[model samples]
Target: MIRSERNPAGDPSGPTHERVFRALRTRIMHGEIIPGQAMTIRGIALEFNVSMTPAREAVRRLTAEGALSMSKTGR
Candidate 1:
């Protein structure tokens, strides 16, 4: 989801990675993310308007938390 500048969810007042992580985590827990859905770090970065670093970190964290499952192909 593209965070809009006028949206409160896009507060832009904290660490980018944390914000991205929280947003994604909430989605996962709330069943917004479907089973077997796949996305790339690059796609995350682009969608969230963040740099690769933050997006990678967020994905890594979610993977570690079991909120996201990584495939052998690293999807």
Candidate 2:
């Protein structure tokens, strides 16, 4: 289980991108998103009710951390 001491929605301690990152990371780690599943920045932004920039940042961070892989086609 992913534990957070702060309430992401109400906490002002972290940036919006960090909140999105933690949420997505937890979902991925918990098997909420299956392997080889299709995901997009637009989809993530919509799901998290955040802007594309934060969504992109979260995706980029996840990719860099080896939690996700991006193909040449940017899938």
Candidate 3:
């Protein structure tokens, strides 16, 4: 199961996209995801037990934040 630290704002229930974002951000920050490791929207969705939309949004947010990058083929 995917586990994450509690929200610092004391809000137990947050948006799915935000939760996914925070979880992914935490993983990135902690070096859990090795540099250049392969990742996919479907994989993230399955791992986080979320739909493709939330996983894509998390990836988009992370990419915008420079936490991840996409190639010409969107890898």
Candidate 4:
């Protein structure tokens, strides 16, 4: 039951990661991100200001949905 100022977006519903993942998913599904866009964990991490873990999970979920294709070389 602790209140914090971390929610500058005024979204008191939940954490920011979920919103980021949703945006990421939409972008990927709509061809905004593009396949073979060379998205690194660090790049995504930086892009969304999320740690490697959540970013990784988001990517994994996207991969599972077949919206994103992962290659061996990360290219």
Best of the two (1, 3) by lDDT: 1
RMSD (CA, Å), candidate 3 to true, equals 5.8
Off by over 4 Å in 1: 1-12
What local distance difference test score does each model get?
0.83, 0.81, 0.82, 0.70
Tens-digit lDDT string for candidate 3 (1-75): 444333323547676778889999999999999889889888888887777887889899999999999777666
Ten residues in sequence with the least summed lDDT for candidate 2 = 1-10
Model 1: worst 10 consecutive residues (lDDT sum): 3-12
TM-score of each: 0.79, 0.79, 0.79, 0.70
TM-score of 2: 0.79
Tens digits of per-residue lDDT, candidate 4, 1-75, equal 543333424666455556557888888768899767888867887887767766777777777888777788753
**On a 0 to 100 scale, what is the lDDT of residue 35 in model 1?**
71
**Model 2: clashing residue pairs?**
none
- List RMSD in Å for every model shown: 5.1, 6.5, 5.8, 3.9
Which pairs of residues collide in model 1? none
Best by lDDT: 1
- Can you write out model 2's per-residue Cα lDDT over 1-75, one digit (the tens) per residue? 533333445667587788889998999999998788888888998997777888889899999998888777666
lDDT score, candidate 4, position 20: 59
